[model samples]
Target: MRSPLRSRLVLLSTCALLLATLSGCDDDSGPTPDAGSQLPEDSGTPDSGAPDASTDSGIPDSGAPDASTDSGTPDSGAPDASTEEPWDGGYTVLEEHGDWIDRGRYAPCSFNRQGDPSTVRCDDLSRYDLSQCSPEALAQLDAYGIYMTDLRGEVPRSDGGTGLLPAFAGFMLHSDGGTDTMNTAPLDFRNTDGGTFFIGSSRTNPITGTTLTALAGCQVPSPGIITGCYARCINGSFNRAGTFEAHRMPSHRGESESSGGLRLISESPVAVGEAVDVYVTKNHAYVVSLDRISGTSGGLTVFDVSDRAHPLFKASISLPGDSSWNGVWAKGDALYIAGNDTGTLIYDISNPAQPEYVRHLPAGQFGVHTVLVDGNRLYGMSPDMVTLVYDVTSPLAPVLLQRITVPEELSSGGAHDAFPYEGRLYVSNGFGGYSVMDVTDLDNVRHLGQYVHGSFAHHSAVGTFAGRTIAFEGTEFNGSHLRVLDVTDPTNIVKIGEFRLSPVNSIHNLILKGNHLYAAWYQEGVRVLDVSNPTKPRQVAHYTTFRDGDPGRRGILFEGTFGIRVPGDGHVYVADSVRGLLILNEL
Candidate 1:
């Protein structure tokens, strides 16, 4: 599940075999980024200081069961289908929690020594005297107005900590002393479209843009700064109220931009459509591609990487009726390919180069978007939000053990991928959100908790860092960033830290090894971060994979590094959207 996180679907009638069209271009000639500034390291856990588990602060209580959903039931209905809507259908109306933002605490301006603007902790826009601003600053403000955007708040859970609510605002103050107007980005709360709620009239134009809210008590304390409380509540159905402070311009420009750690070790081209995901074994690397559209076929291309510097294209497999393989993984001699329409396609890799087709699991028209193999169990995540667990004790014949279902409320599009640790299953539930389940007992697989932010297309990687079970989750969307959550207590999940490049570049797959996180960031290329201190992730290295002038560059949103694998081989394998397989020395 890479490109915008969806199952590769093509009408069976239009299936046609097409050889991968190769374009001649210099892969090694890609420019490396210069060492950029680093973000301030943040530590310490957020003390869950909310009043109570069910703090009904003027907001509608989540105590009542939503009418649209089954009553707290798991595995109760057919997987919810997803339309093109970015929300993806499964949205939980945040229980009304009246005005949780503490304006006083964040109002006093305090500049950090590092001077990193984006750090909300150091975000203090209270000192500027708007009346004393120079004519130039005022003119820029009068024209563009002060746009204070990126208003993010938290939606507390019934347990303890909170879920992230994505919200932003814009305001324009008329210089003629006429009426000032404020507007909000369409808020989709738990699937409910809370159309642009009006924030109040106080406005200011800072160095960057305008900042204002509709909430009546808001104030333009000085100039270019607007402080006020805002809430989104619809007919007492949902509510998430918070205080926000917006500056005219973004504080973190260029602070998060950096390049360089990855050096090209080797490169190989796959004559396929969109080289999406790749998996590596001792002697070979298996790369998969997605079909351009529905009709043409896209299949697997194998390369013998035993010779690291010069990987030879060994064999190519293109099935007549079954293609569109989105993911690839291998355990022992069996290769598991995520068959979009035919469940899990198993191939015998006893002979690495020429893999023999074994069979498809759960035979029939089923879409397996991703596959994860742990010990003797193989977990297949289907697009319908159901995970089929199989006892892969025998490589050839996998026995279906049990069907693990995502909670009905959170199972919107389906389960994108799953990571297993101890007795728990950490799943990246596409539109439903991120979930932690006790797969300890398959029969009574209970859901512990979930973290559903505004962003859909949540794909992930989980690992233990600093004695806490931290999951590095990224969403594949225009503004998606890497969110670090402490899953030690799934019931009380806490967001410990976050990392981002440009909001426009989407994050795909993340591989966590020890204290290092290898991220395949679309457009930004391959990024390596040091997570030794999970609370504040630091970007130590990066390799830019996308070039605006590259040959066959489709200029699409989901273009760049699609898949990445770190098999403890001291090498990083990445699947670039245009460059095919890219091998870099481990940072």
Candidate 2:
């Protein structure tokens, strides 16, 4: 496949060809033999009446053609087909039939023969039927800038009908009714040359002028000669940040990138904080984002919570990892991010647009998994099969107080996520039962307990609402399940209950606000669960944003919504694998 750039170039070249033909200006190669062929052999269907030899135009002699010819009355506006013969040998036959002959000085297919030499060269023949020209222009209608084999560029007939060229190489139409219309993919000059063509959002060939090159080496009527190249192209709007129009998404539904099948009610209109790893909270709002395609990493978005009617993005803090960001938690002005390889990063977003990096946690961790701020205690999971607890009573400095090593054999330790509550931290070990840890003392840690019934446990969240401890872990790889655990009694963590909100699975992340648990379910999308009861959770309603539409559409939901949380108000955010951060309001 030609790169997207090449394909677009071809399309434009073809369009130019169509325009040239309509304007009666054939390429220097002239039209094929019938177009400017001076030889008699090409004057196949010779006209009966010969052109008066006195005429300067060197048209082949076909006997005077019957006045009623296919190309219309011999008006000066159009070529005098009546007197022209299809043969190029200059012999005029008495037979009256449909044929055409060329009669002008020819221009060589002029081009920079050797790099940049000087002025282009020109020479020879003025007429040749499309079939008798150089392979460059002969079978490749696009060669002479002829868009299609059909006579579309022909002088518009008085009947308001159009003439069309023949399909690719089968020049002689076997019969009438054989023209392919524009509906079958517009002919890009490149594509007509058998090159692959790039399609725009509208599927129209968006080739521009400068990019199309006349690759004369290609065979006429053969594949690769015309189909224009389909190059891999990225969807980018020329506009830079702050200037991005809402039209950024594939409004026309063209081929887009691989997202979590979740549609963005609004794809991150704002690029920063896109991979929303940074969490910010204020008197007004909370939010996250799916960053931009540029830069090695994306960032976290902060919102103004001062007013519910309008939640504006107040700041964006970038993560240090060269990879995209994953999770974010903010305490006061300090923000913690799950930096891909750079480990957990702490930053002071007090100066948001210009964040000040504070400290970096240990490495070999992925996802930083999940983070929680309990007073001065900081808890986070490292993909390395270990969970770390930190004492951050000192704002600028965080002391790594403890690390509990969990055996990989005990838990896949795909140790996806963890969150601290009361004095215990609930850790969701991928494929491992949730592990409970006691961190009453930041420096001292103890295994409070664990629930070993295999829970998909990719991530977990703890909410202290109504004086009760409700811990949630995303278990269903593709369903909406707030794996509710009663952690009120930390020493004995129990999977008291679970609330399944939708048929589509893929429960990725969940966050509790007030009495509700905002679950970012992959294909099942984002749902608001009323978790007033630790043992039972119910969904109030759902906003069908742009999720995979339904969970497990194909036995498995590929549209992955990883992080879901409601920073505040009616807005629920979901980070999609395909689409960055999807911001939406609950219905």
Q: Rate the local accuracy (lDDT) of all candidates.
A: 0.54, 0.39
Model 2: residues with Cα > 4 Å off, grouped in runs: 1-268, 272-278, 282-297, 300-321, 365-367, 407-409, 462-470, 487-494, 501-504, 547-560, 567-587
Candidate 1 per-residue C-alpha lDDT over 510-583 given as tens digits, one digit per residue, 9 for 90 to 100: 77655456788766677776565555566666766754335554333455688887664557778886889998
Could you say which candidate leads in lDDT? 1
Location of the lowest summed lDDT over 10 successive residues in candidate 2: 41-50
Error of 2 at 434 (Å): 0.2
Superposed by TM-score, candidate 1 places the C-alpha of residue 9 at a distance from the truth, in angstroms, of 5.6
Candidate 2, after superposition: displacement of residue 562 in Å?
A: 3.3
